[model samples]
Target: MKLLLLTAGSRGDVEPFAALARRAAASGHEVRLALPDRSGVDTTGIDARSLEADFSALIESQGVSPLAAMRSLRDVVRPVMRAVIVNAAQAALEFRPDVIAWHPKVLSAPLIADALGIPHVLVELVPVMTATREFPAAGTVTRSVGPLNRLTYRAAAGAGAMFRREVDEAAEVMGAPRSRRSSAPAATLLPISPAILPRPADWPESAVLTGAWRAREATTDAAAPTPDPALDAFLAAGPFAYAGFGSMAAGDPAARGRALVAAARARGIRLLVATGLGGIAVPDDARGDDVFVTRSVDHGVVLPRAVAAVHHGGIGTVQAATAAGTVSIVVPFIADQPFWGAMLHRRGLAPAPIPRRRVTADRLAEALAAAPAFQTAVEAAAARMADEDGAAEALGVLERLAGRPRNDALRHP
Candidate 1:
C-alpha cells in the first residue's frame, strides 16, 4: 500500500508522523510525507516533499522564532493553506496513494481525500480538534458564547470555502470539474490514551484514542567521544532538573534563565538549561560548575537520566517525559501547551502548571519540590502505556479503514 502523510508546524508536530511513516514503511508500505519546507522533519527513509514556498523567507519575515513563524504563517498564508491542500491533492493523484493520513490542522488533506475518493485519517497530537463534553480541555467559549462560537464556525466555514475556491481554480488549471470534489468518511486518531481522557459521549465513533506515537532514539554509544566534557561532568553528578522551552523561546530568556537558576538553587537541584534557538543567553557570571548550558539534546536521551523535567509543555516534550517515566513541571508559553499542562495536573502526574506570566523563582521552586510525587503517577501511567502498542494499533485501524483484511483472525473473526 502507498500511504501519503501530511503535517505542518514545529518539529514536535512533525516528528510523530515521521515515526508513523517509518513504521508503515517497515510494514512493507510505500510512505510519502508532505510537510512545509520549514517543518525541519528528518526525512530518513520516507520520501519527504515540501510545498512550493520560500521557507527561509517565511521564517525571516516572521522572525527567527518558530512560535512566531507559525502564528505569522497562519495569519499571512490563510489563502496559501488552500493552495497547499490543492497541491497536495495533485501530488496524491500522481502518487495514487492507498490512503491519505494527515495532521488535524491540515484541513486541506481531508478535502483532497474527498476529491480523490480515498480514505483519510486525522492524527491529532493535541486535543484541540475535537470538542468533547467528557474532557474539559476544549475551551468553554468554543462550546458556549453563542455569538462567538458562531463567529468561530463562520471563520472556519469561510476558510473551507476559500479552500474550495482554490481547489476549483486548480481544477480549472488541470481542466477538471470544480464541483466534483467530495469528502470521505474520516477517522481521527489521538495520541492520548483513554486513561487520561475517556471516550466522550459527544465524540464521533470514527475517532480512536491511541497512546502517543513515541519515536525510538538511538542509544548513544559509550565509545563515542563526549561533545562537551563540562556538560558530561554535570550529567555525571547527581540528577539535575532539565529545563528548556522547546521551540517556544521567551522574549526575555536571560531573565527567565536567571529565574530558573535561582529556582534550582532554591530547590537545591542542579540545572541543565537548553538555550532555545539562540534566544536564551546565559550570562557569563551565571555560569558555574553546577550550571550547564547547551543548545539542545535529544529529549529521549536526556529526560530519563534527569531527576525532573521542566518544559514549555510542547506535546513532544510531554510525551518524551512521559515515556521516560520522569515527572514534569510544565510552564506553558502559548497554544495547546496550557491544555497539556492542565491535563497532566488533572492526571496527578504534575503540579498545577505554572503559567508563563505567573512563573517566578519562588513558584518554580515550589513546583520542583512537588515534582517528585508525580514520578509515582508517571511510572504507573508509563507501565500501562508500555503494555499498549500505539504504532501497531494505529496501523491496524488504518489497514481496516483501507479495506485490507485484518492481520489477526481471532480479533476480526
Candidate 2:
C-alpha cells in the first residue's frame, strides 16, 4: 500500500507520524510524508515531500506562546495556512496516495483525499480535537458547561471554515463533487495511549483510541553525535532531571535555561536541559559538573535515566515521559498543553499543571520537589502503554478503511 501523510505544526506534532511512516515502510508499505519546507523535520530514511513555505519564519514571527498566537490567529496564520493547503492539494495530485493520514491542523486534508478518491483518516495526537461533555477544550483548563463543551469541538475545527470555500474550489478544480456537505476525514484515529486517556463512551464509533505511540527504533543526528555522549555521563553521575520545551519557542530561551539552572540549584537537584532550536540559552561557563545544558537528546535515551522530565505538555512529550516512567513537571505554553498538564495532574502523574505565565524559578523548584510522588503512577502508565502498539493499530485502521467504500465519511470506528 502507498500511504501519504499530510502533517503540519511543530516537531512534537510531526514526530509520531514520522515514526508511523517508518513503521508502515518496515511492513512493506511505501510512505511519503508531506510537510512544510525547512521545518527541521528529520526524514533521513523515509520518503518525504517538502512543501514550499517558510514555516519556521512564520512560527518565529508568531512566537512560541500558543495563547499569544491564538489572539491574532485569523489575521496571522490564515493566509499561510491557505497557501499550505493549496500546496497540500498539489502534493495530493502529484503523489496520488492510496490513503492519506493527516494531522488535525491540516485543514485541507479531507478535500485532498476526497479529490483523490481515497480515504482520509483524521489522526488526532490529543483528545481535544473532538468535543465531548467529558471536559472543556484542550486549550482551556476548565470543566464542562452545558453546550459549550460541544462547541469546543467546533472551535478546534473552526479554522476549517475559514478555508472551506478555497477547499471547495480546489475540489471543483480536481473534478470532485462540489455538493459534499463537509470535508471531514473518512475516519478518526486517536493515537494516544489508553493508559493516558481511555476512550470516551460518547465519541463517535468512527473514532478509536489506540495506545500511545512509542517507536521501537531510534533515529540519530548525523550532524552531531547524539543522545550526546556528555549527556549520558551526566545521567550516570546521579539522579538528575531534564527540562525542555520541544517546539514551543520560549519568550527567552537562554533566560529560561538560566532560570531552570537556578531552580534546580535551589531544589538541590542536578538538572540537564535540552535547548531545542535554541529553546534555552546556556552560557559558556554554565555547562559544568552539576547543572548541564545541551542542544537536544533523545527522550527515549534520557528520560528513563532521569528522576523527572520538565517540559511543555505536548502529547509527544507526555507519551515519552509516560513510557519512560519518569515524573512530569508540565509547564504548558498554549493550545492543548493545559489540557495535557491537567490530565497529568488528574492522573496523578504530576503535582500540578504550571501555566507558562506562572513558571517562575521558585514554582519550578517546588514542582521538582514533588517529582517523586509521580513514580507510582508513572510506572503503572508506562507498563500499560508498553503493551500497546499505536502505530500498528493506526495502520490497521488505514488498511481496513482502504478496503471499504471510499466516500463514506461516517463508516468507521
Candidate 3:
C-alpha cells in the first residue's frame, strides 16, 4: 500500500505520524509523510517532505487569555495552517496514495481522499472531534458541564469550518468538486492510552482509541559517538526530576527555569531540564553540577530513570510520562494542557495541577515532595499501556483500507 500521512503543528503533532510511517514502512508498505519543517522530529527511516509554512513561528507565548488566544489563532495561526493544508493537498495529488491519514490540522486530506475515492483516517492527539457526555472538548473546560458536554464539540467543528474555503480551493485544484467531498473518514484514530482516559460510550465505532505511539530509535553505526554525554552522566548520577515544555513558548523561560532550579534545590533533588523550543531557559546564575540543561532528550530513554516528569501537559509528554511509569508534575500553560493535568490528578496519577501562572518555587517543591505518593497509580497505568502498540494498530487500519479496490484513475497513466 502507498500511504500518505499528513500532520501540522509542533513536534507533538508531527511525531505520531512519523512513528506510524516508520511502522508502516517496516511492515513492507510504502509511506510518505508531510509535516512542518521543524527540528526535533525523527524522520530517519521514512520518506518525508516539508510543508510550505513553519508553524512553530506562530506559537504564542503562554498566559494569553482564552479570547485573546482565539483571536490570535484566527489572525496569525489560521493563515499558516491553511497554507500547510494546501501543501498537503498538493502532496496527495503528487503521491496518489492508496490511503491517507492526517492530523485534524490538515483539513484538506478528507477532501482529497473523497475526490480520489480512497480511504482517509483522522488522527487526533486529543478528543476534540467526537462529542461525548463524559467530558467537554479538551481545551474548552477542565471539568464537564453535565449534559451540555456534547455541545462543546461545536468549537472544533467551527475551527475546521474556518478553513472550508481554502480546503475547497485545494481540492478543486485536484479535480474534486465540493460536492464529492462529503464522504466521512474511514476511521478516527486517537493515539491516546485508554488507561489514562477511557473511551466514552458515546463515540462511534469508527473511532478507535489506540494507545500512544512511540517511535523506534534509528539504528546507529557502531562508530557513531554518543549524542550527549552530559545527559547520560546526569542520569547515571542518581534519580532526578525531568522537566521540559516541548514546543510551548512558556512566558519568560529564564524566570521559569530559575524557579524550577530553586524548587529542585529546596527539595534537594537532582534536575534534568530540557529547554525545548524555548519553553524553559536555564539562567546563567542557576547552572550548577546538580542541574543539567539540554536542548532535548529522548523521553523514552530518560523518563524511565527519573523520579518524576514535569511538563506543560502536552498529550505527548503526558503519554510519555505514563508509559515510563514516572509520576507527573504538570505545570500547564495554555489550551488543553490544564485539562490533561487535571485528568491526571483526578486519576491519582499526579499532584493537583499547578497552572503556570501559579507556579512558584515553594509550590513546585511541595509538588515534588508529594510526587512519591502517586507512584503506585502511575505504575498501574503504565502496566495497562505497556502492551499497546498504537502505531501498529493505526497501520493495520490503513492496510485494511488499502485492500479495497483503489482509484486507479487518480494514479499516473
Distance from true location, Cα of 21 in model 1, Å: 0.5
lDDT of each: 0.69, 0.76, 0.83
1-413: candidate 2 lDDT, tens digit per residue = 88999888777777888888988888899888888766655788989887665556666777765575667667776666766676777778888889899887676677677667677888888776776777777776545566667777667656567667666666665667664654467778888888888777688888888876546575222232344577666777787889988767767776677778888888878988887765667676555677887667777778877788899888888888888888899988777888888888987888798877776788888988888878998899989887889889888888887745475544321
Q: For this target, which candidate reaches the highest lDDT against the unseen true structure?
A: 3
Residue 304, candidate 3: Cα error in Å is 0.9
lDDT of 1 at 50: 73
> Which run of 10 residues does model 2 get worst, by summed lDDT?
218-227
Taking the tens digit of each residue's C-alpha lDDT, what string does model 3 give over 95-208? 999999988888788778877778788898898888899999999999989999999988987877777777877877778876343556778899999888899998998899
For all the candidates, what are their Cα RMSDs to the real structure?
A: 5.7, 3.4, 4.2
lDDT value for model 2: 0.76
Give the 10-residue window scoring lowest on summed lDDT in candidate 3. Answer: 217-226
Q: Which ranges of candidate 3 are over 4 A from the true structure? A: 60-76, 178-181, 216-226, 403-413
Per-residue lDDT of candidate 1, residues 367-387 (tens digit)? 999998788889887677666
Question: After superposing candidate 2, which stretches have Cα over 4 Å from the reference?
Answer: 65-76, 165-169, 177-180, 219-227, 283-287, 407-413
Best candidate, TM-score-wise? 3
Instruction: Name the lDDT of candidate 3.
Output: 0.83
Error of 3 at 242 (Å): 1.1
